[model samples]
Target: MTTVAFIGLGAMGYRMAAHLPQHFDSVLVWNRNVDKAKQHAAEFNTQAVTLAEAAQADIIFSCLPTSHQVDEIIHQVDIKSGAIWIDCTSGVPDIARTQATYLKSKNVSFLDAPVSGQTIGAENATLTFMVGGDAEVFDKALPAMQALGKLIKHVGGSGAGFAVKAVNNMLLAVHLCAAAEGFTTLKAHGVNLNEALDCINASSGKSGVTENVLSQRIFNRSFPNTFALLLLAKDTGIALDLVRDAKLSAPVIALSQSLIQAASATSDADSDFSAAVKMYESWSKITLE
Candidate 1:
């Protein structure tokens, strides 16, 4: 029986980690917030312990916020050889490679398995995982991965997962901003917002934004915290860095990155990304709802 340890019980991490008890006998939980970790462990009837204690598990899953935080945990913990560490952090590819290589030298296996589909997908256990690591290690982690996500793929070697995630999030920003621009344009021209979405979703202009963000968040007028604007800004910047680092010629990606970066600097920087629609509305002098 493989022992499991889950770190960083944030919004998505908590939902993702909650599924481990369904498959593993002992699923240890750890978070920077001690109270959150203790409560989560109590909810799952698992262990709430220190980083060193959690590091002792046969397999560990981390869904932290940034690469720096991930590196900090790796250095702070007392993980031994043969322990497998799977990081679901949406982070920098270079950092992922640097850490993965370091962990490999310590005989600790690493998988950069960044995820998509946000909190809804995580709560439903249908998130998409873009995993990057050795093929054999992927096979070893498959059962646990199955417990957390539905669309799981072994993308490539170390850092490939973050690369895929960067691209995925980059496109998401493009689509979302496209939707925002479209809504603003329609409203400026006096088109009813709901009707426009009705037509767009049924037509070729449909996207996740039209099908999900606009309908669920913008139309509802609440735009609750599903995923934060600061995070979106960071993810888009990661994609932009990927393009520049690889010498790719993607003008639209760079433009989208700038749009989100600017929006993230606004007063609602901590709001849901769907709140971008509000920003668009304010700037365009048009209201979607």
Candidate 2:
């Protein structure tokens, strides 16, 4: 029976890890919070083990919050030879490359597979996975990834997944801010938000932010525990760094980054990224509600 170990049992990680036991005979889980790990094990009928024990599996999957956490896990765990390390975290590409090289030295292959859907998507098993690593490594992990996501593509070699993820999220941030600002402007002018959202959805102005997140979650006040604004801001920072490193000019992304940064500073950072609309509301002294 194939064995797999999953680390980080947070919102998305918990659901993603649950599907692993359905495909693999033995699935082990670990979390910084032992209770969460134990809860997941009980819920999924899997084993909750220490990081050292979990690392012995044929494959080790990590969905941490940041590059620092990934570094800590890699340093603290005792992963065995020939185990594949798949990172589901949205981290810096250079850090992903560095970790890939470090893991490869220990005979463990590494793949960066950052996902593009949120909590609802995870629960529905419809996330999009952008993978960066050897084609063979991606092929080997396809079946397991398929259990958690609907779309999986190998974007490029080492660190490319994060690169693509950063770019994708940067654009998402811009689109979301645009949608929120437009909605807020319309609402200020006495336009009904629901009707305006309907029109936007039908028009070329629609985007994933408008159609999926803003209209569905923000206007409805469902929240739905998708990715948080703080995390989104972190990703924006990563994207900004990438552009800065490349000496590329992206004025719009820079503006979006400032908006996200301002939102992250507020109490709403713990809320969903669509909460950026609240920032504009605060600035304009107009309540979205």
Candidate 3:
């Protein structure tokens, strides 16, 4: 019977950890908030343990907020020498690779497995995972990851997952901004919002933003907190760093990053990423809702 340890009990982490008990014989959970960890452990019929105890599991999964959090957890915990560490955080690629190297010195295998799809997707087990690490280690962890996502792909080695996640999120941000601008423009020209979405969905202009997020969430005025604007802005910064390091010219992505940064500065930081529409509305002096 394999034992797995899960760290972080936030939105995505909480849902992801719920599936572990179903797959593994024993599952240990740890969180900074002891009450939350205890609640989840009771709900899932799992064990609530300290970080050090959880670190002794064969596999240790971390779904933290940032690379700095991951570093702090690593330093505080006493993980078994040969335990596998899987990071689900959308962290910097270079930082992920450096952490992987450091963990290797202790005979611990590290993999970056940043996820896509928001909170609803996490609840539905429909998230897509982009993984980066050793082939053998990935194969071993595949079954565990399958419990949390519908699609999982090995992008490459070490930092590849972060690289792919950054690129994908950069494009998502750009598409969302463009969709918001287009939606606002069409409304200004006296077109119905729903009608404009119908035409766009049938045309080449349609994207994930239009087909999934905008059509479903934004139009409904639900604005449920799925992926926060601040997180998206942080991801954009990571993408910008990747682009700069590669000396690549990505004007649209750069622009989108700036727009998201501005959005994050507003109260929308705690709202959904779809709230980028709020930034456009503020600029055009028009309300989509």
Candidate 4:
């Protein structure tokens, strides 16, 4: 059986790592905060250990928050040859490629396999993974990913996962802002929100925002959802870097990035990204609820 090390135990990581021991014979974890790592280790039947200990595992999966963090952790840890490093960070494509290249020189393999489906998806083992790496490496990584996600695809080589994740998040920013603006517009015209959402969901004017976010977080104004607005805003910047690097034109994406950035700056950084609705509410002076 394959031995594994799962790092970064944030909201998504905690749940994702908890599911790993069931698949692998020995799954180890190490958090900056030792107690949390121990707690998770105990519950998941894994070991709580140091970074070097985690690095010795055959497979290392990271759910870190940023590309820089991924880079930093990989460099800082005393990882060895023959280990497979799969980064699940929503991050910069170029950086992922660079990491893969660096690891390859040492006889270690790397894959950027950023995930989707959010916290609920992680907990339910129904997440989707966009993987970027060699075909052979991907084949080796597939079973471990399947333990955490339902849909898994090897999109392309090296940084493909990062490319897809950035683009996906860029669109999510656009949709979230549109959802916020749509809700405010509907409220302004005295249209019933519930009815509008139902119609929109049944028609073309719907997205993850309308189908899932609007009712659960924005309309209720609860925003207990665990995703970070700051992270979304940061990812938008990374996505734009990709677009601009490719010399593509995207006016709406630019505007949506600005709105999400401003909201991340003004609203609680740690709040669920659905708090993006607060940006439109502030501008229109009408709350969704």
lDDT of residue 172 for candidate 2: 89
lDDT, candidate 2, equals: 0.87
lDDT, candidate 1, 1-289, per-residue tens? 7899999999999888888899999899998899999998888777898988999999999988899999998988779679889999998899988998999888999999998989988888999999998999999998888999999999999999999998988898999998888778787788888988999989999998899888788887888897888888899999999889989899999999998888888837569887876678778777777
Candidate 4: the clashing residue pairs are none
Error of 2 at 201 (Å): 0.8
Per-candidate TM equals: 0.97, 0.96, 0.97, 0.98
lDDT for each residue of candidate 3 in 17-66, tens digit (9 for 90 to 100): 98888788899999999999999988988799998899999898899888
The number of clashing residue pairs in each candidate reads: 0, 0, 0, 0
RMSD of every prediction:
1.0, 1.3, 1.2, 0.9
Per-residue accuracy of model 2 over 1-289 as CA lDDT, tens digit each: 6789898988999988988877889999999899999999889888999999989999888998998899888988778999898899998899989999999899999999999888767787898999999999999888888988999999999989998998888898999888777877888899988877788889998898778887577877776656888888999999999999999999999999998888889845468777777778778887654
Candidate 1 deviates by what RMSD?
A: 1.0
Overall lDDT per candidate, in order of appearance: 0.89, 0.87, 0.88, 0.89
Q: Residue 80 deviation, candidate 4, in Å?
A: 2.7
lDDT of 4 by residue, 163-226 (tens): 8998898899999888877778888999999998999999988898889988998888799858
Off by over 4 Å in 3: none
TM-score (C-alpha) between model 3 and the true structure: 0.97
Error of 2 at 270 (Å): 2.0
